[model samples]
Target: MCNSVVLGVDIGTSSTKAVALTLDGQILGIATRTHQVDRSHPGRVSMDGEIWWQEFVGLCTELSPHAPGGFAAIGASGMGPTLMLCDAAGRGVAPAALYGVDTRAVEQIRQLEDAFGAEEIYRTGDSYLSTQSVGPKFAWFRQHDPEAYAAARTFHMPASLLVHRLTGAYVLDHQAAGQCSPLYDAARHRWIAERCELVAPGITFPRLAWAGDRAGEVTRTAAAQVPGLRAGAPVTVGTIDAWAEAHSVGATEVGDLMLMYGTTMCLVATQDHRVRHPSMWGSPGLVPGRWTLAGGMGTSGAITAWVRDLLGGSSYDSLTCDAAASGPGARGLLMLPYFDGERTPILDPSARGTICGLTVRHTRGDLFRATLESVGYAVRHHLETFHEAGIVPRRAIAVGGGVRSALSAQLVSDITGLPQQLTRISIGASYGDAHLAAGLLADTPPLSDWNPVVRVIEPRPEPAYDELYRLYRQLYESTRDIQHALAARHSASAGEPLPDHRATATAPERSVTAPERSAPVSPAGPDTPRSPR
Candidate 1:
């Protein structure tokens, strides 16, 4: 029984991962299943919710052999406040609308802000309405797809979706529920019933629980589908992947910030009291009586992937090498990392990517280096915002697939002038899920013993970054109007007009990718396998 393992699975934006680990945090086995999201239309990113379940089963089946005595418990997390509206039978009616990356709810955000009054909404929700909020997406669905909306009975984010599939328990963590801005009252820690009727009428909201609380036992149906998972094993109510990743690295202490470099870059600052700002999001922490101030950039590694794909398909290692050779200022090139528009602080879906000071003298390496620096500047911007909100992080711990790049982490530290602590087991949110699941056991060790800081990335004094940071801030303001106009032109060219009373269109076609494969296991260090959410 002491050797029995806990299973942790996470459904993310680009992939789903599962890990089997013991109570003291020795990772025995890990698996990853990579997939892509649908971007057939502009400002829209989605995936079939059923794909999440399929990947969950595949990952669990692959990792089952590592746990010989059968799994003791299960925990899950995912990229969220996503919206996956379901029918009476718990099947997704349409592709799940992803988080802030899907900006189709811009107009709906404005409408909700006006209807509820920005200040009142902030007072209740503890965060301003933006592309990240779940309410506007609900309103968008209500207005565009009336038939699907009428048929929808319940909704789930990635974590809750997995919980429901495994345990037959429809529940969401309070941290996730709070991000459903304007639909959740943060002070009261309950769903705003009137707001629910206003945005998603007749849709039943899931019951709320803490991230570590036991939701239910795995059902016989799920046990048969997932190899080695016992029918009566308990499962924890997991929260969003970012928060789970935070917990993985012991970032829940007051004044500790978890900096996640993944599909998108996110910063979560844990606090004892709530911190509210129009630009940042505030949510309940993983446990009761704790709070978090969170914000993210809409693009990070996504930009890196775009650059890599565009400049011939070279591996990440070769690209990093070329980027490092290009040196500190990127040969006078600068970039705005807003290819998918911006989030947090700016919150402008109309924003567009910009590369300034480009000339024939510049090479692909310079462009890639500029892209990395752009993310650093964005991180500095968010840190400044956190400082203004009176929540200064005493320590910043870096985790995720992006942390696999030493150049990326070092550049961020140099630009922000803050040291970043890298943890021992950076297998990401799945590892954190295991930690949550282990809490159900009486003899579970502390998180510090489970995972500890292995290295610290100290900041170097870079004179070029100070000047570049000034220009980076100015570039956005100077080009705001032009970017908005071009964004409108791009939308018009895409020609997927929003549905109205005159005509309603069917959902976009689902994309099929190669079969999921397991990432080879590596030693515990900077190179550990992590699929960025």
Candidate 2:
């Protein structure tokens, strides 16, 4: 069999995508499987952890035909840093708690902050404790479900889970480790033992590696499940989906920013040194020594989806056309795209979506356009935060499904007053995964050769957007109290108590139940296995 092709797969909030690509970045085949997250409880977002592996196997099987010659190496990425508990056999013990979208850890966040001084935590973690943090989520898991906590032998995010199943190497990338906050010390690039014990006692965290580092070879067992992958195929260490998406479009340079338009709108700016702020996330970059400053909106395409479904399931193409005709300012309508709370910049979980200046004259187009523009405003807010932190990204590369909408992509450029480069291949993280996999081989081609910039969307700023942007910021400040009240009311009716940090003190540290082990075995060595043809 030919050994020139590699495979990459990504598990996302709404779908799983697998792509097979030649070493030179020619996409041989792409397969996608759609799924939804569980939002059964208020302020919580989760998904059946088992479904991730299930879809991976299915997608690999379907895409195998295109890779006639077995895949030489494989790479994976996914939506994270999710909290998924696993047993000794690597099976998920419960539904995985998703990232910032899951706001069940507010109380835990306060408890941890009080226990460990907030400033100290931020100083070490390079990020502040928020819904985006995994430490608080671990605390919430231990507090809310002690049984599962005790039963869990290890914890994993989606990508790491796939790696464990594929190569029997339990590992987490440095980029993902930084997102654990408090639990990880970004400066040292290691887990904080005291913080880990306090939040998730006895949990065996995965060994840390960089995103493209080789974790191990695909095991014979994994080979049986995934077609086109031989038992000894190399597999790169996995990372979060957004970072992978950034790499896909060559946005990993120090002065580059990747704006992802997907279930959420994420902005990741590459930096040479650590850059931390109260309103943004600073984490280890895909490779060691490099760092990243990032921000995310809780909703983007999700809002558009909600609008489309609300308008009797109108097609996105039709809705986008209508929104384009609605013009800038969305016909005097303004929106706060905080449908599932927000992340980065204003870290407000209780924030709710609001559309002001709505009248009977407003049509579906107006509503859709306002929804799209709201995300643009949110992107602008993130850019402002970057400026506040003294980071001015020299280049902005756009990727993801939302970028497929000409109107949506254009609105973001116009509102943010930034030109966005579009990549030739837009398969998102899966393509990035394949690129990472290709890097494991010698004589790898440069990113420009794989996926060059195809077009540019330049800003067409308008006076109307400038005015609306000011009101957009003011609208949130003016309605914050009301939004909090509504969120509290909804939680109360749902029989969920919003934790009151005022009355609570520090959370007590817990003891470890599992026996301590020696240092983790590094995945690299001269004897490391290679793919067999």
Candidate 3:
């Protein structure tokens, strides 16, 4: 029975990870595949939905040998509230539009606000119309790609896409549904059919279920395509990767903030009552009777990876070591980590990355340290919003690959003055998915016991960080107009229309093309969806 274990998989922005684990929380094997997002045009980020299933098959195939006894159950997760419209037969109509990072729906957001008063939209959706909301993307499709919208009979996020492929189930978790802003009624915990019809006419909403509930059993056809799993193995209705990561670290209690350090930085603060703010997102928690206030930065580890690549693909360890030596404030360097535009508190899709106070004497180390500190300031901005909303966190838990760097974690702690709790396992959302799968069994152990707090990252006061943060706030305001103008120029040069409702109406007719095939999988492995964790 040692080989009989539950499986968990998460499709993230930059990679896909899978893990096999015993019911008692012992990991048998883990696999990860890193891939890049497609950015053929400015403000557009997407991935082939087919890659999500392909990576799942690859990961399961790689882990199958280690689990000789056979699989017990499966749990799935991915970066979301993404928009992947599909036909009635379940094939993707187009490449999946990623979460907030893809900022092509600005006009759609405004249209929704105008149609449904902003106040009423927030009252129903628990959030304002921001890039993070899925509703605007739906509107964007209807307005821009009428053919695709006409063909789309269903919508799927990464988790639901995998679930449908595995179990032949057409369903989405309630937590994911809540993020569909204006289309979902947070108070009622269900889709608002009227609003759905208004934004995305002629679409069918998937059946809704709790994140941990069993979605369905693996169909015989799916079992044959993927080795080591028999037909009828239970599959849980998985949720957004960040929420699953939150559950993995036992961060579901009121006043517990789960800070995820990954491709993008995300924060999920559990609360007893729903709290609505214009800048942050509010959604139903993984379980009933709980709510979460969430916020995310557009770039975190992504910027560091960019810097590494720019410096001829040096090892991250070397970069971290050099960054540590650069000391606080990065020797008079400050950066705005908005390479993909900003999200949360700022919500500016036109914002571009800015580097201030650069000198020829400064090394790559100083630039890298400034990048890390930039994320720290962003974290502070989000946490300050939480405080203003009267949702101060009693405990802040940090997880993901970025947490491995003491320099980065310390910078966040120093900026926020909040101690960060580190768990024994930091494999990320995949570990959490395994825990959720195990819960379906009657004999599963408590999740808190599965992964315990290994250490606490305490803040060492740094006066320089305070002064730098002040400048960070001012930096964005001072450069807003220039960034907007440059963003417009980039769009024009790319032949991409600026956000305008009339542009789609007046644009020349073009034949609808099928989504392009995903980039060939690298020798190392396959890829998955987008967003922070």
Top candidate on TM-score is 2
lDDT of 1: 0.84
Candidate 2: list runs displaced more than 4 Å: 1-3, 500-533
lDDT of 2 by residue, 1-533 (tens): 23488899999999999999888778888999999999979889999989999998898889888777668899999998899998878988889999988989988888888899877877787777878889888888788988887788888899998899999998889899899987887766777777777677777777778999999999998887678778888999989999999998889998999999999999999977777667677888998658888888888999989999999999999988899899999888999999988886788888889999999999999999999999999999999888877789899999999889998999999999999999898889999999899888866776877899999999995978888999999999899878888988988998997654221111111111211122322323121111111
RMSD of 2: 6.6
- Model 1 spans > 4 angstroms off: 497-533
Q: On lDDT, who's better, 2 or 3? A: 2
Candidate 1 per-residue lDDT over residues 352-426, each given as its tens digit: 899999999999889999999999999999998888778778999999999999999999999999999998988
Enumerate residue pairs that collide in model 3.
Answer: 13-530, 264-532
Local accuracy by lDDT, each model: 0.84, 0.85, 0.84
lDDT, model 3, position 31:
95
Candidate 2 vs 3: which has more TM-score: 2
Each model's total of backbone clashes: 0, 0, 2
lDDT per residue for candidate 3 within 1-533, as digits (tens), equals 44468999999999999999987799889999888789997788999988998899999999998666557789999999999999977899988899988888978888888898776877777777778889999888887888888888888999999889989898898789888887887776777767777787778778788899889998989888898676888899999999999988998888899999999999999987777666778888898767888999888999998999999999989999999999999999999998988778677787889999999999999999999999999999998888766778999999999999988998999987989999999999999999888877646666679999999999998888889999999998899778777888888999986664221221112221211122221111111111110
Arranged by lDDT, best first: 2, 1, 3
Task: Name the 10 consecutive residues with the lowest summed lDDT in model 2.
Answer: 503-512
